[model samples]
Target: MGTERDKGAEQGTVHYSGTEGGWGSVRGIVETALRERPKPAALDALRRQNKPGGFMCVSCAWTKPKHPHTFEFCENGAKATLWELTSRRCTPEFFAEHTVTELKGWKDYDLEQTGRLTHPMRYDHATDKYVPCSWNEAFDAIGRELKAIDPKSAIFYSSGRASLETSYMYALFARLYGHNNLPDSSNMCHETTSVALKDVTGSPVGTCILSDFDLCDAIFFFGQNPGTNSPRLLHPLQEAVKRGCKIVTFNPIREKGLEVFKNPQSPKEMLTPAATPISCLYLQVKTGGDIAAITGMMKHVFAKEAERWAAEKIHVLDVDFIEQHTDGFDALKAHVDGTSWEQIEQESGLVRADIEAAADVYIEAKRSIAMYGMGLTQHVHGSDNIKQLVNLFLLKGNIGRDGAGISPVRGHSNVQGQRTVGISEKPELVPLDRLAEQYGFEPPRDEGRTTVHVCEGIQSGEVKAFIGLGGNFLRAIPEQERMEAAWTTLRLTVQIATKLNRSHLINGQVAYLLPCLGRSEEDMQVTGAQAVTMEDSLSCIHGSIGRATPASPDLKSEPAIVAGLAKATLPPNPKVRWDDWVADYGLVRDAIEETYPEQFHDFNKRVFTPGGFYRGNSARERVWKTKSGKADFTLPKKLNSWGTEDKDGRWRLMTLRSNDQFNTTIYGYSDRLRGIEGTRDVLLMNPDDIAAAGLKQGQIVGLASDADDGMDRQVGGLTVTPFLLPRGCIGGYYPEMNPLVPLSWHDEESKTPAGKSVPVRIVV
Candidate 1:
C-alpha cells in the first residue's frame, strides 16, 4: 500500500518541455548528480571547457579524454555538470535563517536547491544556526579535537570519486595516525565483488576491459542498466549490436538502456531521431536470483556441450584453453552436472528453453564478456553470486582470453580505482607488506569494520563519529531510520563535500560541513596547479586537472583537507611526505609508484598522454592469476532461497531509481521508464499480490517492516499501486523507501546493505 502512481517517463518519449527537449530538467539532473545546484553560468562554463589538462567529468568514472569529441556527456555526466555549474549557493546566511531541523524538513531536492556551499560552517546549536568561520579556525578545531583523541577512534572515510592523490594521503594519514580505520564508499557497493573475485580469481579487480567488449560474441548483462546509470557504455553496446554481437540481460525489471537508446552525441541520431534497440535477449531473473540464473545458463551450456561432443560435434567449448590453463575442472564438471534443471528454472524465473536459448548464443559467440552491476552484488549471498558469475565465464573458457572475460561495471568513475589506490577496509598481506617495507612500521593486520559494522558499532555506541570524505553516508546507507539514530550517537562528524545534503542535517554532537572543490575546479599548489589521478572501471590510471574555479573561497582540495588534519594529529612518518604530497599531488603519485609498481609505473608522467593507460588486465592475454595460474571453475550450489515467492504475507521491497534520479541524488521526480512523474512515493506491485493483500491498486499503504525481534518498523505515507513487478516483490525508488531496509539486512560477506531485498508488510 504505497504510492502507486504512474511516473511514466517512458523510454524514447520526448517531453515537449523545451527547445533542447527539457534539457533544463536534464541539466538539473546533471547538477544534483554531482551534489551541486545549477547556476546561470553553466553553459558558458561548459563552452569554455575541454581545456587540455582538466580533470575529466567527475561523474561516472568512465575513461578520461582521448580523441576530440564535442561532448563526452552521459546522463549522469550532464547531471554532474549542472550541479557543478549551478547558479545557487547554500550560504551560511541561509543556514542562519533556517535551523538544521527546518532544513531537514525540506525535500532532498529543495535542500540542494540552496546552491553550492561556500564556506566551512559549524552548527551553533546554542543559536540553532550554522555560522561561517575562518578556514584556520575550522582546521584548528579539527587539529585540536583530533590531538585530544586516540588515533584508533578517528575513522577517515573516502568516496569513490576521491583521486589517487587524495586516497594515498588518506591511507597514509590513517596508518600513520596508528589505526587503519579507512572506511570508504566501496564498503557500500562492490566490496562483495572485490572480496569474492580476489578469493576465486586472485585479482581484486574485474578481469574484463573496454576493448574486451569488442571481441565478445555474447555479452551477458545481469541486473545492470547502462542506459540511465553508465550511459557512456551504450557506445560499446550499440557498437556490438551494429557488429551483430549478442547481448542477453538478466534483470527482473527491463532496463531502458538495454531496450533502446539514442546517442545524444550523434548529430544524425539526435536530429532525425532513431533509437537503437540494444539487447537481443532479456531475462527477468528475480532479485537475488542471479546466482541461480547464471548457474542455470551454465548448467544448460555444460550439458549441451557434453551432448554435442558425445555426438562428435567438433566446436562447442574452448577445450584446449581450459585444459591448458585451468585447475579443478573435474570437480567443477561434476558439481555442475549434478545441478538439476528443475531447481535452476524455479529459482531463475527462466525455463529450460530460456537457458538453452542463452547457451545457443554462447555457443555461437567465440568470445564473450559477462558484465554485471549492483544487482548481482547487493544480496545476502552476494559473494556467492559473484563466484557463480566467475563459474559461468570459466565454463566457457571466457577468462584469460580476448573478447571474453567477467566485468563488474562499477558505479562511480573510480570505485574500482579508489580500491586500486589503497582505500580498502581489509588490506591483505601484500598491502601490509608494502607498508612495512616503505614506512618501517607494520600496519595492523586485523580486519576492521565494514559499512554495516560501522553503523552497528555506531548504533551500539562503539563508533565515535563518521568522517565522510564524500558521498551521502546517511542516505546511501541502507536502513535509513537506524542509520539516522546511529548518526546521533557520534561526538563529532565532518563531511568534505561540494554541496548541501540530508547528511548535513543528520549531525553529531559537534558537526562540521567543510566545502570542497569539485573535480572541475582548479587546485593551485606551490609547484603548480595540481593534478589528481583516478582509476576507471577498466583499472586504467589517469590524471585530472580542474579547469573551473573553486565554488567558494573557503573550500579546499580533499587531499589537502586530509593532510591538514593528519599533520596536526599524527607523528612524523617520513616514508610518507604528508605536507609535500598535499602541497603537490605529484608527490602522492610518487609514493603510489613506490608501492604499486605493478600498476602505477611512472605514475606521474604517464597520465599526461591523454588516452591514459590501462592497468594491465591479465585477462587480455589469457593470463589467469588463480592458484593454478588459470581462472578456477567454481561449482554453484542449489538455490536455497525461495526469493520473492517465499516472502508471502511479508512484502519484498526492491529499491530502484526514477529516470530523472541518479544514485542517491534525486534531481527530479520523473522516471520515464516506469511512468512515474514528480514523486518517489509510489510502489509497483503485481496485480495478483495486490489482491492477495486485500488492497486496491493505486491506494496508499503504510508499509511496515518486520524486525528480527518480531516487531515492525511502521513506515507511513507510501502509495501502493498494483502494477507489474514479479509476484511477492514491490518495486519503489531507493533512499525514499530506504527507511524500510534494516541496517542488519546486509550481504554477510560484503556488509553492503540489502537495498534489493527487504521484508515488509503493508496496511491501508
Candidate 2:
C-alpha cells in the first residue's frame, strides 16, 4: 500500500557539493510552511512578508531592498515566520498534561511544537503546572515582587526580536523603576563590533549601507556563512560576481555559501542550470587567528607599497585620505612590520603566498568592503580582532567612502535598534539630562551589569529579580547548567514571549509567563491598529505593520505589557501617564523623538514614509567625530592563543548553530545544509585528528574543557564524525556545547564569552 510520508521525520545523513539557495531551498520552505500552516495561511503570510507596509521577518537583520519583490523572504525567514504562526496551541489544557519537570525533559523543538502560548500563565506550586491568570493579577503579583526588592537587585534583559518602540519603553520603564541593569542579546553577539568599531570609526554602527555592494570592487568576507545566517545577502554577492567584483572569504570551515550560490529569484539563472561562484580566494584561518591573518596581509601591503613607492615615486595607499582623516598610522605600520611571516603563517594556518594574494586583491581594488559575523566576535580577543580588520581597511582608506567600509553582520532583526533606543548598561551611552528633563525622572547614570556581569551577580546572590523582554536566557548564556541553576534562586523571573522555551521551564520562587503579541499579529489600541518601527543592519528605520489577526485574543502587545507592568510597579507620578502612552504608540515615538531630538527628528512622519529614513551615521559621510577628530589606527597589543592545545592535548572547540535552528530555537532534528540528519549530538572533527585520538566514526565520546574556573564543564555522549575541518579543531552545536564554555572565558573589554574558541579534550 502506498503511504503518505511523514515529511517532518528525519532519515539519514546526506551530503552534497551543490551551492545553497536553489530549488532545494524552495522545497525546504514550502515543506516546512505547509506542515505548520494551511495553504491559504502560508500563502497570505508569504505575500505580506517584507512588503512595503507588511510585517518584518523576525529573523536576521539583513536590509530589505528599496523596491522589494513580493516574495522577499528567504527559506529560513519563511521557516521562522511559519514557526511563529503555527496552529498548534499551548493552552491551559496542554499545560495540564505536562508538568514543569516533564516539560524540562522534552527536546527544545518538542517544547516549541506544543505551540503558541494562549494566555498569561503563573506557576502554581501545588499543581506543579502553569495556570491561567488575568493580566491585572499577573501584573499586580509582579509589582509586589518589584516593590519588595531593591531596584539595584532587579536585572532587565532585552532580546533583539523586540521592536524599537517596545525596547525604548522597556528601557525607560526600567530606569524610572530605579535600576540600570539593562543587558541584552547584543552583549552576546556583536558587542565586540559595537565597542571596537566605535574606537576606530568614531561611531558604533558600520560605515557601509546595502547599496555599497553595487559600487564596491571587492568584498572580503571574514568568518561568515551567508547561506544560512543571512541568505538575502547572496543576491548582492551574485550581482557582484556578475559585475566582476572579487569576493575573498576567510573561514575555518568551507561553508557551501562561500563556494557558490544559485539565486532562485533570478529568472535568467533559473531558466538555465548555473551557480554563481562566490569566493575567488577561500582561506581557512585557524580558530581565533583572524588577527594574525589580517596582520600578515597588512605586512604584505606595506612591503609592496614600498616597492611601488620606489618605482613610480607614489605610494600604493590613498595618501591624501590617510593624511587627512586618520591618526596613529605610523604606530600601526611599525607593529605590522615587526610581525614575522613565520609566526603569522604558523598562527593563521595560511601560507605567506595566499596572504599576499588576498592583500594584492585589497590593494588593487578602488573600493572594498570587509564583512564579518559572530565567527570573528566570539573570541577572547574579539574586540582586538575587529580592530585589526578596521586597521586593515584604514590603511588603504577603505572606510567612510562610497562602496568601501566595514559591515559587521548582526544576528537579530533589531539588535542595533535596541541599542540605539537606550538598551545599554554603559552610563555614557545613556542620555541622562534629556531623559530626566523630558520624563520627569532622574535616569541612572552609573555603569551597570552586562550579560557576563549579570551572570556573576545572579550566581553571587546580588541580583534577585530578572525581567526578560524577549529571548531564552537559559539557553543563550554561557555555562548553561550554572545559568539555569542560578535562575532558580531569583525572587521573581518574568518572560515576555509568544511560545514555550527553556527559560520558562526554570522558574524562580515566583514566575510569570506573560504571553505577548508577535510582530505578525495586529496590535490594536485605543487609537486603532498601531504599527511599530524596526531598524535594519544598514541603519534604515522602517515601519512593520502586522496584517495577520492575533494568534490569541488574550495576548497583549509588548508595549502594552510593559506599560501595564510599569503602571502597577512604578511609584505614583501624576506627571507621567503610562495609560496615555499605552493608548497610543505614537506617544512613545514622540517621546523617543523628544529624548533624542538630534537623531529622531520628525519620527512619526518619517517612519510612515515609503522606506522610512536613515539614522544618519557620521562615519558613513566621512565625518570623523573621535576624540582626536579623526579615525584612529589601533593595534592589537598581544597575539591571542585561545584555541591552541595545552599540555593535555586538547583541541579547539567552537560552538555553532545547526542549519535547523536559529540562536537557541531548534526548528527540526536535521541540519539540512551539512546533510546531517536525525540528530545534532555529533562532533565534527578532522579525519587525521580522529585517527590520532583512536576514535572511529559513530563512536560516542565525552568532552571536557581546559578551564579550571571552579566550574565542572563537560559534554558527554557526542558521536564523533569525520569532517573537513583543520587539524586540532572540533565543532559542536551551540547551547549543547555551551556547557563546555566557562563563564570566565570571555573577552576582557567587551565581556563576550569566547564561544568560538574553547579548549577541550575528548574522552574515550
Best by lDDT: 2
Q: Which ten residues in a row have the lowest lDDT in candidate 1?
A: 1-10
Pairs of residues clashing in candidate 2: none
CA lDDT, candidate 2, residue 281: 88
Candidate 1 Cα misplacement greater than 4 A, ranges: 1-41, 44-52, 313-315, 573-575, 619-623, 627-629, 640-647
lDDT of 1 by residue, 1-764 (tens): 01112124222222222222223334545545455544555554454333235556666765544653566566666776676767678887788789888888888878777878898888787876789987777777877777776666667887788887788778776776666677787788788788788767778777776777767788889878776677778877888888888888877776667766666666666666555767777766767777777767777777778788889876476788678877778887677677788877777766778777877888778888888888877776777888878877776678876687878887776777777766776757237788788988867766666777777777888777567888887888866776787787788888888878898888887888889888877788778888887887777776677756677777888888888777766677676677787777777888888888988887777876665777786655666666777767765444622223464577667788666756776676766555556667877777667777787756787777764556556667777665546566678777787777777777776777777777777767
Instruction: TM-score each candidate.
Output: 0.92, 0.96
Worst 10 residues of 2 by lDDT: 1-10
Question: How good is model 2 by TM-score?
Answer: 0.96
Top candidate on TM-score is 2
**After superposition, which runs of candidate 2 have C-alpha atoms over 4 Å from their true positions?**
1-15, 641-648
Residue-by-residue lDDT tens digits, candidate 2, 127-161: 88999999999999999999899999999899998
